[model samples]
Target: MTELPRDRVRELLDAVLDDEASDRDDMARRVYISPFHFSRQFRLGTYESPVALRRRVILERAAWRLRRGDSVTDVALSEGYESVEGFSRAFSRAFGFPPSAAERTSTHWLPAPNGIHFHPPTSLWVDSAEAPRSSMDPTTQMVHHDIDDTRYLLELAGKVAVRDYDRPLLPRHVVLGWDGPEESIAAVLEHLIWSKEVWLASIDGADVPARGGRDIGALAARHETAAPRFISAVQRIAAEDRWGDVLIDALCDPPESFVLGSVISHVLTFSAYRRQVVRQMLRNVGVEADQGDPIMWLRTRHQPSHER
Candidate 1:
């Protein structure tokens, strides 16, 4: 697949936004390509049709102007809409609200697949960060909570009597079929840390990680090592927009493949369940285990200790 060079892509984009370029035919002429080829190239480069991108960028600009207290009629006429009624319809469809309400919106940017958005003062802002900008994004929030809660459980497990830590109190508690039963605090905690180690190994293309020590100190050590690496791997995947990329695991008897996104989801799902299991196991041993609810975790995490 021949991809457009960045310079050429910029040139074509510039031509599309040229003030005198009235339509697709005019845009193609400015770029010295036939209308058909220009459309094809533009779509291939930006994953959007030229006309559609133009309209979106225009609406984005209108949104920016409106949020800054520009009159709807003024913005509508400046963006080439024939009337305020037509502009209102387009704005409502693109932004899910009338232009009159733009001042109340938190952001002016809409969902865009290509990451190309309108820059202030007549330019394009190409966002290279494909992932959510905040650490509090849902996936990252869950990952942080999982890591924190797991470590807290390990600390609680360390205080349990050695016999209770190893006792099989929860009967027939199985999460994944292949990992077998997790009926003891030791078993559940080990699985919780070990699963992340295994997945990180697979992601790094290293040989399968050797099963580590199952004691509290050992489990804590293993988790401390793997937790940051796991978070780094997920961040890299998101930054590169590689969630759909596949990993072929030769460690499987017959090689198996997994999508990167699904792999993260699998780890988070099972880890969440195992965290609760460990909490219950702690309670069974007459230890105080926090509720382990993310809602509570987030609330307590952000609020002042005095308020909590």
Candidate 2:
């Protein structure tokens, strides 16, 4: 295995998790420096590309979760499998048996085709390599937006409406709707718009108000309104270097207005919850969002720039 310097290795690792290096072109662009130089250093240092490292990390985490007694199903999908069958096949190939074999032993290890073995009670095998970083890596800071490459998965809802075409307001997730504690994507967007104002209040002299839901034509409109608000706030914050601390504090500590979200864990961050809602909505309609690839949508105009 290549011995990677921690910082540089971390950069390569983040690139993989964010899927910035999916294709040869993207991988070349992300590895940066000279292609030959990076390739050699990558092998010498991390012993893997951004991609292999990422897979190793995911599998390691999954193994840890299994040892913690998390259900195999939970571990599978969390690692990004689309279906139980798919996950089971892959798991069997990796572990020599399906995840079911895991339940039999507390700290059993099953060898994987990926070169990494599935060692349960992975905490004991815990390499610092397996720990999740505190703040998202730079590449992952804006992950929520890039992860959903396709804009407005509203087609499924449109189809549903077209089939019957009689629901004045589109039902949230068709299956879940907005009946439970879980808000719809529309609600999540509205909350995201308000979250900016809330964040600003914690920094600038603004006052955080109840989340604005004055009834827009669509959730996109509300999210759009916040773009200008976030732009203005970030611009003003940039003017004063100390304000970076303020934004961080705001990010870390939700204002009183956000207490409801914090309590539910569902309404937390604007980008986070909204991103999750989009993925769920897509799943409900059978769309596989590019959750693994955060840079896929960075080319779009929806960026939240950290003005310097």
Candidate 3:
């Protein structure tokens, strides 16, 4: 079978995520592909049929809602199941537990075959396991790899020429999908640091330090202080295996709740994307920034010079 383009698959997956009520036919129509071809391509690319993927995603959403205290009947109806019994049967098959049991125990559900996972009410992303593990066990060392690269990127950003530090390399609307008062390189770096603090505050319920202004030095220093806190938090979470604890985020107007593991995944995803943005911006301004590829970082950090 011919391999489908990854970008096209991502588009289709995003469409499915946007509307779980949409059937495979609707999805094919939206993407302007025939249902037969779309189904074949989707299955080949994602290791699951389009319909199966959508159902699994919807069921995962249902599990998250159930954990967040939503009634099983309401979640069932919202997810398009006609009755509680039907929803319960499907939920049990997908997650190995009924909706009520999931709500009571509040355990972590397995990720989708495609590696796309959700954190409830909001937040979804394709898992990119590009970073190398510091140890054989992923659960223990993934966060350390993230922390190391985060600090490295911040140090590289600090070396950008002073005049170009605050220059607008990419518009805020393009980078963040919305307009903001500040759209400079420095603003992106500050936002990167500030985002971690936000997640840290949500995880620990402690007062975080104020965001460093446009000064890259100050931002680096603030990040140096904040990065360890996040490392500690992740270590603690990993040690206790509390990846499924529900966290109520006070930052949202209605207050959003997400599984703790999802929040950590969100942090890793956000950091990876923004760090590359900063690296590219630095390169644009004539700084000889490393490519900032996580794998390359790992190779340089681990293997000796004469290994090859």
Candidate 4:
């Protein structure tokens, strides 16, 4: 499966903030996705339109500066808003008041590591989580781990893949290459989003299609390609606004030679490594990860969950 166009995602963000790539048609073409499809997918994946997401990102950065007492005009320019009025309108829309109001207030609202917070008083509003940026509160580590569990449905797709096909074939396990360690594929994918569900928990991400996927079985009976199925899982994650954005951000401007196999290996290794880290990080706090199906360590050294 292929990921979405990273440059297009960047362009949409920049367009929203700076009009750097203001051509709507170009925006649509860059993702190789239609504007409507693109907009819908962007909203589903990011919980905001390309434009709105960009604005929020801008506001977040601007808010950081505002908290430091950067002037409205300066904040606007920093955010790439053409004029102060333009920046104010967008900022007001995001925060429910103008920058002037923000300046007047002693406390401002925003998310902190484990919770939401307001300045001046520093009141806490939420609990700490694994993926705070995505607002996901999970006990499992965001780092990668070996996984042996497979969705019964995904296995069904794999069975269909070997047969005669007029359609596509999906796999229960997201297979990238027989050449590399299976761990690598899982790791690379996890590094993209840092979601703990798939690699660290018994639960899988919402992006995993339901037991009965989008009529994918029929495709499995057809041309018989697993790539389509894997792509669907990634896109489902992307469209659902999950921590997939973390993955998206990681790839938005990735290094030129992102060795797919080696990276996946690292990602999977991290899961086991992180569980060790989590054990240490939480031991003092009394939040321990009981060894079980998801977290199967062999001896003092880490082992792949597949063997468990």
Best by TM-score: 1
lDDT of 2 by residue, 1-308 (tens): 99965566445444555533554346556756555444434432332333444455566566567766789888888678788788777666545566766666554442221123333432223233222223444422342232122123332333333322222233533322332333444444344455555554555444444455423334334443333334333333333433324133443434233332232133223355455565665555555554524454433223322210
- TM-score, per-candidate, Cα-based: 0.56, 0.33, 0.51, 0.30
Model 3 has an lDDT value of: 0.66
Residue by residue across 1-308, what tens digits does model 3's lDDT show?
A: 99965566577676566664367788888777777666645543454556666776678778878888889889999889889999999888667677888767654444443456665556665554312223656643455555555556665666777878887777643444432534567877777778788788778675654656658667755665465557657766766889999998786668889999998887777666777777777778777676766566456445432241
Cα RMSD, model 1: 23.1
**Lowest lDDT 10-residue stretch of candidate 2:** 299-308
In the order shown, the candidates' Cα RMSDs to the true structure are 23.1, 22.4, 20.4, 20.3
Candidate 2 ranges with C-alpha deviation above 4 Å: 1-180, 210-218, 243-270, 286-288, 299-308
**Residue 142 miss distance in model 2 (angstroms):** 2.0
lDDT by residue for model 4 (1-308), tens: 99875543344444444435454455566656677555544432322335433444456667656877889989898667899999888778557688877756544543222222222221223333311233222222221113211121222223332232112112232333422222222222222223222222112223432121223333222111222123223334434545323232232235123333333345445545533332332333333434423433222113221221
lDDT winner between candidates 1 and 2? 1
lDDT of 1 by residue, 208-228 (tens): 978989988789767766765
Off by over 4 Å in 3: 1-134, 139-142, 174-182, 304-308
For model 1, the local distance difference test gives 0.81
Q: Which pairs, if any, clash in model 3?
A: none
Reference-based TM-score, model 3: 0.51
Q: How many residue pairs clash in each candidate?
A: 0, 1, 0, 20
Query: Which segments of model 4 are wrong by more than 4 Å?
Result: 1-19, 101-308
